[model samples]
Target: MTYKNEQLSEEKVFKDPVHRYVHVRDRVIWDLIATPEFQRLRRIKQLGTTNLTFHGAEHSRFNHSLGVYEIVRRIINMFEDRPHWNKEERLLSLCAALLHDLGHGPFSHSFEKVFKLDHEQFTQRIIVGDTTINQILEKVSPGFSQKVADVIGKTYKDKLVVSLISSQIDADRMDYLIRDAYFTGVSYGHFDMERIMRVMRPIDDQVVIKSTGMHAVEDYIMSRYQMYWQVYFHPVTRSAEVILTKILHRAKELFEDGNYTFKLEPVHFISFFNGDVKLDEYLKLDESIVQYYFQLWQDEDDEILRDLSERFINRRLFKYVEFNPNLQMKEWMKLYKLFQYAGIDPEYYLVVDSSSDLPYDFYRPGEEGERLPIHLLMPDGSLKELSRHSDIVEAISGKKRTDHKLYFPKDRIEELEDKQLVKQIKQILYGQGEVENVR
Candidate 1:
C-alpha cells in the first residue's frame, strides 16, 4: 500500500495531443502498454476509414487509449480521500482504460460488420487469457486481471468505478469526443472537461454532476450531439465505408468462384469469408495488414476487386446525393436498369446509404437496450433526470436524426463513352438537368 514500491525509477511520458502527455510512474502500467498485444493498436486507426474524408484523422487507437488512461488518472486524483472511491481502485480504472480497445481490429466497424467479431470479447481474452496483458495484471494479484476485465465488462459491481470508464459521459467518451474533434478539426467536441471533472462527485453507487455544473453537463450533451452528426456520422466517412463493404463483398465472391488467384491468399480474410475467425488471427490483423492486402488487390485480375481496392486506397470516394426512401419499387428498378445500361456496375457503383443516431434519449418504460439515464444532483440534495432539467436534452430525446444518400461515381458518368445511355441514366437520377437539393 506504500507509494515508494510502486514508483518507477524515472518518470515515463508518452507525447499525446488529447491528454498532452500520458505519464507513467507505475511499472505495471508501463509493461502492459509495451506488450505486443497493446503495441498492435499503433496499426489500428482510431476513426477507421474516416481518414479517407478527414485527411488529418490518421491518429491511431493507441493515441486514444493513452488519452483515456490519462483522463482516468486525473479522475482518480480527484478521489484521493472521497468516500465510495477507494484509492485501491485507482490501478483498476487505469488498467481498464488502457485495455478497453485491446480487441479492436483493422477498420474496426467495417470488419466487425463483415466478420461478426466482438472487440470486447477479445479484450477480455487478452486480459484473462495466457497473454502479456494477463501476466502483467496478475503481477498485482492473482485475481486482479479478472477485476480489471470486470470493470471493462461493466460487471465490476462498483457503479462508480464502472462509470469512470464506461458511463454515458465517462473518461472514455470525454477523451474521445475531444480527441476526435481535435484530430478531425471540428468545433463540436469542445466541452468544459476540466469544469466537469471539478464538479464530479462519487455518489452512492454512481458518479453524479453537482447542481452547480449543470451548464457544463448541458455543454457536454450538445458537444456529443454535434459530434455524432458532424464527425461520427459524416456522409463522406460513410462513402468510404460503403466502398470498404463492397471490397469485402467482391473478395468473398472471388474466393467463392475460384476464378481468382491472389498473389498470396488472404489467409486472414478466409475465416472472415467463412464467417468464423479465430482470436489469434484477429489479433494479427491491423490497418497495415489490411492495407497491404488492399495494395496488392489493386492489381487483381478481377475487375470488381481491383476497382474497389483502388478506390479505397486512392480515396476515389463514392459521390453522394440526397435520396428519397419512400419511392415506388418501379422507380428503383428504373434506376438500376439505367445504371446498367450506362455500363456502370449497379451492384458496386450504385448504393443507398442511410445513417441514424439519437444524441440523447430518456429511458422508456418498456424500452429495450435502454441507457441508464444521466442524473444531476440538485442543490437541495435531490436528483433530477437530465431530460427533466435540460431543455436541450428534452428536444433531442426520442428524435432520431437520419440521413439518406444515393451514391454513385459522377466522374465515371461524366466521361461515359455512350452519350445517349448516359443521358437517360442522368435523367433518371436528376429530373431534368440538375440533381434535387434535398438538403
Candidate 2:
C-alpha cells in the first residue's frame, strides 16, 4: 500500500473531552503522532498561563493538535464527494492540521518575544527540515514535506487546502475555540460546530457556509468574540504573562552582565541570550525546563531575578491599571520615574501589555494577512460575503479594537515607607487621589 493510502487494520481512538473520540485510520498520521517531537507537545500547555486564571485550563497542545486533526478529518470527509474538492489533497490537509502547532514552545508568547523567535517559522522548519515530522511526510512522498510546510505557511498552490487550516474560520480556530473553552470551563467558546461543518461547502478554492447555516456561523463568530475578551485576553492571565516575560528578560540581562552569577547555569538559554538559537537548541526547551531554571534563579544573588522568579513560581502577579500609551505618554514617564524613586525596578515591575482583535474582517486586497472573507452559499446559487447578510457580523467586520494595561506590583507599592509616593501614584492611576479597591 502507498504511504498516503496506508491505513491501520483497526482505527486508533483517543478519547477527547472536546471531540469525544478522535479516530486515527491513516498509518502516516498514527506514526507521526508517535514521533518524539509530536509527543513533546504533551508537555506544553495549550493555554500557557491561562491555567493560573482558569484553574481547569491544564490541557496541553497534544490535546489541541489531535482535536484539530479530527476537525479537519471530518471536514475533508464531508468534502470527499463534492465537486471542486480534490480527493488527493485529503491527506495533505489532515497532515497539516495535525502538525500545525508542532513547533510551539512552552510559554510561547513570552519566549518568542524575549528571544526574537517565531513559532510559525519554527513550525515550517520542523516540517521541511531534518526532523522526524519531515521524515514521516517524506516517506509518504519526496516533496510532501514541503507541501505540508506550504500549507502551514499559507503559501500553498491550493488555496482550498490552505484555507482548511489557516483561514479565519478554519479547522485550527474551530477546534481551539471549543477545546480551550472546554478546558478553561468557560461558556464563551461554545457554538454549533457540528451544524457549521455540515453546511460547509467548497467553491472556487475556498470553503463557504450555506445560507441556511448562517445562524450557526454567527454563533461561532460571536463565540469567538466573547472568548477573545473573556478568556484569551483576560487581564489576570496577561498579568501572569507580564511576569513571565519580565522573568525571561531579567535572566537574559543578568546573563549578559559580567558581574552576576547564576546558581544554575542556563545552558538551554545561552543561544537565546546570544540571539542565535539553533533548531536543536530550540526544541530542547519546554515549560518544565523553564520552571527548573526559574526555581534555581529564585535562589540567585540577583535581586530582580530572584524576586521575579519567586512571583512567577508562586502565582504572585502584578496588578494593572488601564492606560493608553498613545494618549498618556507624559503620565507613563512620570510613573516610570516614581517607580524608580519608590525602589521598584521600573523595567521589571512596570509593563504595558496590549491585546487587539479584528474579530471579523473581509478581504482587504493590499493588507498583509488579509482573511478571505467568510462567504455564504445562497440558495439562489450565488455567493455573498458574510457581513452583507449578517447584521451582527457586519457591525464588527473591518473594525479593530485594542486594550492596553499598565501592570505594576501593587503589593510593593502599598508597602512604601513614603505614603505620599503611593498617594501620587494612585492619583496618576485613578485620576483622583482615591485608589479603587479593584485589583
Candidate 3:
C-alpha cells in the first residue's frame, strides 16, 4: 500500500481529557504526528501565561491540536455520503485541522508582538519548507503540502473545507472552547458541541447549522464571549502576560546594545532580536528554552532585565489601574516623569495594555480581520444569518468591547524612601479618596 493509504495494524488511541480518545489509523496521519515539528507543539503551552492565573491550565497545544483533529474526524464521519460533501476532500480537511496550530511559538502572542512574527506564516513555511511535515505531505501528492498550507491560511479553493477549520463556528474554535474550559476549570467555555456538529450542513461554500440547532450555536457563541472576558482576558493572567512581554522587550533591547555583556549567551534570541528568524531557528524555540533564558537573565547585570526576569520567574506581576490614554495624557506624562525621577525606567515600568473583543460580527466589506458570519438553515431550506434567528446571539452580535489598563510595579513604588513621591503617584493611579485605602 502507498504511504498515504496505508493503515496501521491497530488503531492508535490517545487518551484525551477533553475528547476522551483521539484515534489514528491513516499512516500519513500517524507519521505526521511523529515528526519533530509536530512534536515541538508539546513544549508550547496552549494558554501561554494563563497557567499562572489558573493553576490547572498547563495543557499544551499538542493536546488542543489532537482535539481539533478528532472533532473534524467526527464531523467528516457524519458528513459521509451527505449532499454537498465530497469524500475526496476528507483527508485534506483532516490534515488541515490537525496542523492548523503547528506554528505557534513559546508564549505565542507576546513573542509575535515583540518579534512581529505571524505563527500562521510560520505554519505555512513548515508545511512547504524542507521539513519532515513537508516530506510527509509530499508523499500524498506533489503539491499537497501547499494545499494544506492554503487550507490553514484560509486561501484554499474549497470554501466548505476551509469553513470546517477556519469558520466562526468551526472545529478549531469548538475544540478549544471545551478543551480550554476543561483545563482552566471554568464553566464559561461549556457548550453542547455534539448538537451543533450533528445539525451542521454542508452548503455550497459554507457550513450552516440547522435551525433546530440554533440554540446550541447560540450557547457556543456566548461561551466564546464569556471565555474571552472571564478566562482568556482574566486580569491576573494579563498581568503575567505584561511581565512576560516586558521581559522579552528588555532582553531584545539588551541584545541590541553593544556595550552590554551577558553572563550567559542568548543564542536562542539572536535571530528574534535581529528580526530575521529562519524556520530552523524558530522551531528550536519553545517554552522551556524561553524559561531557561529567563532564569539566567535573573542574574544578569542589567538591572531592568534582571528585575523583569525575576518578576516573571517568581510571579511578581505588576498591579494595574484602569487607564484612559486619550483623556489622561497629562497624568500619563506626570507619571512617566515621576518614575524617572525615582530612578525607575518608565519605558519598562509603566505599560499601557489594552484588550478588546467583538463577540460576534457580521461581515462588513473592506473591514480589517473580516470574518464570515454564522448561518442557520431554516426549515424552508433557505439560509439566514444567525443574528436574525436568535435574540441572545443578536444582542452581542457586532458589538465590540474594549478594556484598557496601565500596569506598573506598585511594590517598587512603595519601597521608595521618598514617601511623598509615592503618595503623588498613588493619587494619580487612584483618586484622592482611594489613595489612603491602598496598601
Candidate 3: tens digits of C-alpha lDDT, residues 223-342: 999999999898889999988988898888877987888898899999999999999999999999999999999999999999999999999999999998988877888889889999
Error of 2 at 41 (Å): 0.5
lDDT per residue (tens digit) for residues 1-439 in model 1:
5421387889999988776788998888888899999999999999998877778899989999999999888888987788878876888888899889898888888888766778888888778987888888888887999998898888897778888888777999998999999999988999999999998888888888887898898899899988888888899999999999889888888888887788789997887788777667777888888899999999998887888899999999888877766663454567687777776788999888888887777767777766677788899988888889888778887788888888888888889887776776677666665433211
State the lDDT at 341 in candidate 2. 89
Best-to-worst order by lDDT is: 3, 2, 1
How displaced is residue 411 in candidate 2, in Å?
A: 1.1
Q: Is candidate 1 or candidate 3 better by lDDT?
A: 3
Per-residue lDDT of model 2, residues 1-439, tens digit only: 8878999999999999988999999999999999988999999999999999999999999999999999999999999999999999999998999999989989987778888888989999888888898899999989999999999988899999999988879889999999999988889999999999999999989999999999999999999999999999999999999999999998888889867778778999999999998888888899999999998888888888899999999999999999999998878788888889888999998899999998999989988877789999999989999999999999999999899999999999999998888888889877784433312
Angstrom error at residue 291, model 3: 0.4
Misplaced by over 4 Å in model 1 are 1-5, 327-330, 433-439
Question: How far in Å is the alpha carbon of 436 misplaced in model 3?
Answer: 18
Q: Which TM-score value belongs to model 2?
A: 0.97
